[model samples]
Every structure is written in C-alpha cells, then in structure tokens.
Target: MLEIKNLSYRVENADIVNSVDLLVPDRSFMVITGPNGGGKTSLAKLVMGISTPTGGSIFWDGQDITALSVTQRARLGISYGFQQPPRFKGMKVRDLLEIAAGEHISHDKACSYLTKVGLCARDYIERDVDSSLSGGEVKRIEIATVLARRCKLMIFDEPEAGIDLWSFARLTETFQEIHDRKEASILIISHQERIIRLADEIVLLAGGKITAKGSVDEVYPQIVSDTVAGCNRLEVKGAC
Candidate 1:
C-alpha cells in the first residue's frame, strides 16, 4: 500500500502540491486526475522522488521513503513512467528492456512486452530509442520498458497522451489485463474518461488537494458536470 500524509510542494511561493493525503491499497488500480497545472504531475514526482517535497511524509508498505532517491524508490519496487518519455540515442529497444528487467531477457520475451503495448516487436526490437521514432512509438516503447520491470507499484503519467485511437484502445486493454492479474498496485495519472473509467477508485485533485474521491459510478458524473476546476469534462461513452 502507498500512503501519503500532509504532502506539499512549493516553488516561487506557489503551493504546487499542498497538504494532500492519499491511500492506494494493495493490488488496486487508482487514477489521479484533475485539470492541467493542478499539481498532479508534481505530486507524482514527489512520490517517485523526482522532486523533493517541501513538507510531509510518504510511506509504502509501512516503510518511510520520503528521503529516498529515485533509484532508491525503484529498488524498493516503485516504477514511474513519464508523461513525456525520454529517448536513448544509442540504446537498442532490446537493450533497454534488458536493463529494465535487471537481466538479459530473450527476444521472444521482449517481443511479448512490446506486443502488450500494441507495438510490432520485430519492427522495433533492433531500433534505437532515439529521435527517429514518432511520439506515439516512443510512448509505447517506454510503457513496454516499465512492464519489463514488473515492479510492485507502477506509476504511469498519462500513458495515452501521444498514441492513436487504435493504440489507445489496445493500451486500455493492457491496463485492464494488469488490473485483472493482481500483479501489482497501479497508479495512473490521466484525465481521459476512457482511462478514468478503468480505475477501481478515482481521486479528484484540484489546487494540489484531493477534493473528492470514490468509485467511478459516484465520481464520474460529478466530474462530467464540471463540479471542479482543472477537470477535462470529457463525454461519457458506451452506456457509461
């Protein structure tokens, strides 16, 4: 489980993330969502150790990890996927997957990970993780790398940001599969209703605070009604 208490992040006198409390239970899929600039990304960074918190504590599985570095957190079974994934100029796709796996993985295993993220394994297995790939391709590849790690807690920041509709559909399926497997606790930062509906619970963050929380059936309508600032107000689909 992941628990945060009174967390805050300030910069240039702005409370980017202020006094927030959250709990993500074991093997559950949760989504953190709000309008842009509402400190969603910053909160994720603080939890992942990408940024230092101004105050408060972070605990995972009863251990305090507030002072741990990013690597420390990763070593403790925490993994984060970037909103805008970075590229590796000279790294082969397979090489990157191997590093993420913490050991050499076979070509077939690597291909399976790629396939999970809706990528063609043979087409990308030997390619460089550089500027040559399109934004969507890079995004998917990054997700594949995260999957290779098989961490206990996976934090994904906007996994559907750069992908096409078809790819997004496939990506959602992958998320569903993850949730079904109970392999880990999933924390995804996304605003798409399509993605939000997948969460076992939804956290509505606004102005760096969680203003509302509940199951999709309870919170989805409230969000679509524009009850909070920074909300995307996406349309409901497929009888939802």
Candidate 2:
C-alpha cells in the first residue's frame, strides 16, 4: 500500500504539487489522468523518489520513505518506468533484463518478457540499448525491464506515448496480465481512454491537485464529458 500525506512540492516559487493526500491500496491498478503540465509526471517522480517532496510524508507499507533515495526505494520494491527511456550505449537487451531481474534468467524467461511487449525475443534480446532502437521499441523494452524486476509497486509514466497502435494493444494486454497474474500495484499516467478504462480506480489531477478520484464507472464519464466540452470550446476560439 502507498499512503501520501499532505505531499507538496514547489519550484521557482511555484507549487508544482500542492498539498495532496492519496491512498493506493495493494493489488490494484490506478490511473492518473490530466492534461499536459498538470503535474501528473511530477507526482510520479515524487513517489519514485526522483524528486523529493518539500513537505509532508510518503509512506509505503507504513514506513516513512519520503527521504529515501531512488535506489533505496527500488530496493524496497518500487520501480519507475520513465516517460522517455534512457539509452544504454554498451548494454544489450538481455543483459539489461538480467540486471533488472536480479538473477540468472534463462533465454525462455527473457523471451516471455519481451514477447509481452510485442517484441520477438530472437530479434531484440541481442540488440544493444542504444539510439539504434526506435523510441517505441525502447519504451517497450523499458516496460519489459519493469516486468523483469517484478516490483510490488510499479509506476509507468505515459507508457502509450510513442507506441504504435499494434504495440499499444500489446502493451494494454501486458498491463492487464501484470495486474491479473502478479497482482502488482500499478500506477499508470496516461490520457488514453482505453488505458483509463482498465483502471480499477481513476485519479484526476489538474493544476497540481486531485480534483476527483473514484472507480472507473464513477469518475470517467465526468472527465470525458468535461474534456470534450473544453476541447470544443478551445476549437471555437482557435486555441487548439
């Protein structure tokens, strides 16, 4: 379980994340949705300890982990997949998976992980994690790494960003598989309707604050209607 108590962060005299409190129970999938620059990514970073909270505390399973470093948090079963995955100049895909798995994973097991993200193991396992791989490919590999880690708490920031339609479908299935098979707690940040509908609970973040949070059936309709109306208004004014 993850408990965020009055968590707040500020930068350049502006509060990027306000005093927000949230609770994410175990074995559940939660989706955070909002427009761009709405603090969704910042909130994920704070949970992953990539950015420290200026106020309040973050408790994971009753332990105060607000001050723990990123590596320390990862050691305690927290994993974060970035919006833009980094390139590894000298690392092979197989090697990275092995490192993430933290054990000797056989070729079959490695293939299983890659296949979940729509990559053929024979083609990708030996490839280096460099610029040679396209953005979509690297993102999928990053997700595979997260699966290999098998963390209890996994946070994925905009997993659908660079993925094509075919790969996006595979990624959705992979997320569902993770929730169904491993019972992992997943916090996904995305604006895609399909992804949002998969959530057991939806958290709506706007202007660095949670405006609404509830089950999919409870919260999604309001968000969708409001967003569509806002878009139409913007189109009328030539702002979009």
Candidate 3:
C-alpha cells in the first residue's frame, strides 16, 4: 500500500498541495481529477519523488520513503510517466524499451508493448525518439516504456493528452488489462471520463486539497452535475 500523510508542497508561500492525505491500496486503480491547476500533477510528482514535499511523509509498503531520491524510489518499483514526456535524441525505440525493462526484451515482446499503445512496432522499433516523432507519438511511446517497466506502481500524468481517438480507445483498454492482472497499482491524473470510469476509486482534488474521494458510483455523478459552461470542466468523450 502507498500511504501519504499530511503531504504538502508550497512555493513562494503558495500551497500547490496542502495537508493532503491519501492511501492507494494494493493492486488498485485510482484516478485523480479536478479543474486545471488543482495540483494533480504536483501531487503525482511528490509521490514519485520528482518533487520534494515541504512537509509530511510518504510510505510505501510500510517503508519510510519520504527522503528517498527519484532514482531510489524507482529502484523500489515505482515508475512515473511525465505529462510532457522527454525525448532521447539518439535512442531507438527498442533501446528505450529495453532500458525501461532493465533487460534485452525479445522483438515480439517489444512489439506487444508498442501494440498496446496503438503503434506498429515494425515502424517505430528502429525509429529515433527525437524531434521527428510528433508530440502524441512521443507521449504514447513514453507510455509504452512505462508499461515495459512493469513496476509495482505506475503513475501516469494525463495519459490521454495529445492522443487521437483511436489511440485513446486502445490506451484505455490497455489500462483495463493492466488493472485486471492485479500486477501493480495504477495512479493516473486524467480528466477523460473513459479513463475515470476505469478507476476503482476517484479522488477529486481542487485548490491543492482533496475535496472528495470515493468509488465511481459514489462520486462520478456529482462530478458530472458540477460541469458548467465557460470554465474548465471534465470532458465527456464518446456516447454516455
């Protein structure tokens, strides 16, 4: 289990994440959603050790990891996917996946991960992860690498951003498959209802605080009702 107690992040007297507490049970799928600037990404960064919390402690499976570095946390089986994934100018797609897996994966295994993200492995396996690929392509490729890691916990920041409709559909299916396997805990920061529906639990974070947290049936309806015009609202894609 992942336990966060009194977690807070402040910058220049502004609290990006304030006195928040959360628990992600083993093998659970949780989605964090709210209006933009709700500190969703910041919270994920803190959990992944990418951002240092000004106060509070983070514990993973009864281990005190509050002071661990990002690499240390990763070594403890935590993986984080960035909102704007980074690019490796001289690395082949296959190489990146292998590095993520910490082993030389077979061609078919590499292809399977690519396929899960809606990419044709043959076409991208040798391609350089550089400026040539579109933003959406890079995003999907980065997601595939995270899958390759097969860590104990996977945190994705806005996995749906920049993805096309078809690809997004495939991505959602992949997330479902991962959850069903019960191999790891998944935490995603996404506003897409399709992704939100996959969560075993939903956390509504606003103004750097957790406003609501519960099962989908318990919390989703209220969120849908709160949608308003001329404001950042949760997106409802496809037929309801």
Candidate 4:
C-alpha cells in the first residue's frame, strides 16, 4: 500500500501540492482527476520521487520513503510513466524493454509486451526509440516498459494523451486486464471518462486538496455535475 500524509510541494511562492493525504491500497486501481491546475501531476511526481515533497511523508508498504531518490524509488518497485515520455535516439525498443525488466528478456517476451500496448512486435522491437517514431508511438512504448516492469505500484500520468483511438482502446483494455488479474496497485491521472470507469475508486483533487474520494458511482457524478466548484469537467467518453 502507498500512504501519503500531509504531502505538499512549493515553488517560488505557491504551493503546487498542498498538505494532501491519500492512500492507494494494494491491488487497487485508483484514478486522480480534477481541473488542469489541480496539481494531479505534481502529486504523482512526489510519489515517484521525481520531485521531493516539501512537507509530509511518503510511505510505501509502511516504509518512510519521503527522502528516496527516483532511482531508489524504482528499486522499491514504484514505476511512473511520464505525461510526455522522453525519446532515446539510439536505444532499440528491445533494449529498453529488457532494461525495464532488469534481465535478458527474450525477443518473444519483449514482443508480447508491445502487443499488449497494441503495437506489432516485429516492427518496433528492433526500432530505435527516437524522433523517428510518432509521439503516440513513443508513449505506447513507455507504457509497455512500465507494464513489463510489473512494479508493486504503477503510476501513469495521462496515458491517453497523444494516443490514437485504436491504440488508446487497446491500452484501456490492457489496463483492465491488469486490474482483473490483480497485477499491481495502479494509480492513473486522467479526466477521460473511459479511464475513470476503470478506477475501483476515484479521487477528486482540486486546489491541491482532495475535494472528494469514493467509488466511481459515488464520486464521478458529482465531478460532472454543474454544482461542484472547481470541477474542471471531464473529457467525457463512452462507458464500458
């Protein structure tokens, strides 16, 4: 389980993430959503150790990991997929997947992960993760790496961004598969209804605070409702 207490981040003079507290239980799928500046991404970064929290503590499985570095956090089985995954000029897709797996993963295994993300293995397994590939393709590859890791807690920052409908459809199915199998505890930041529907619970964060958190039916209705303040309405999508 991941426990965040009084978590916060400050820059210049503003608090990007206030004294927020959240919990993601083991084997659960949780989605965090709110307006664009709700600090959803900042909270994810804090959890992944990409950015240090200026206050509060981050505990993973009951360990105080507030001061852990990004690499140290990864060693603890916490993986994060960036909103815009960086490209590697010379690294082949196969190499990246192997590195993510931390072993000499076979070509077949690497291809299987790619297929999970809706990409043909043969075409991409040997290709470089560079500018040659489209942004959407790059995003899929990064997602594939996170899946391949099979981390204890996987955090995805807007996995749907830059993805085509066909691929995004496949990606959503992949998330469902992982959830169904209890592959890992999942935390995703997205406002898309499709992704929200996948959440076992939804957390509404606005103004660096959790305005609400509960089951989809419990929290989602209020999110799209007109009366909620700072709702930052969802980018609605079809239901499952």
Model number with the top lDDT: 3
CA lDDT scores, all candidates in order: 0.91, 0.91, 0.93, 0.91
What tens-digit string does per-residue lDDT give for candidate 3 at 14-132?
Answer: 99999999999999999999888899999999999989999999999999999999989998999999999999999999999999999989999999999999998899999999999
Candidate 4 residue-wise lDDT at 108: 92
Q: What is the number of backbone collisions in each predicted candidate, taken in the order shown?
A: 1, 0, 0, 0
CA displacement after TM-score superposition, residue 220 of candidate 3 (Å): 1.3
- Cα error, residue 179 of model 3, in Å, equals 0.9
Worst 10 residues of 4 by lDDT: 231-240
Model 2, 145-174: lDDT tens digits are: 998999999999999988999989999998
- Count backbone overlaps in model 2: 0
- Please list all clashing residue pairs in model 1, or write none if there are none: 35-230
For candidate 4, write residues 1-240 as lDDT tens digits.
999999999998788899998999999999999878889999999999888888999999999999999999999999999998999989999999999999998889999999999999989999999999999999999999999998999999999998999999999999999999998999999978999999999998877888899999999788878333543444222211
Model 2 is weakest, by summed lDDT over 10 consecutive residues, at 229-238
Q: Could you list the CA RMSD of all candidates, in the order they appear?
A: 4.7, 2.6, 4.3, 4.6
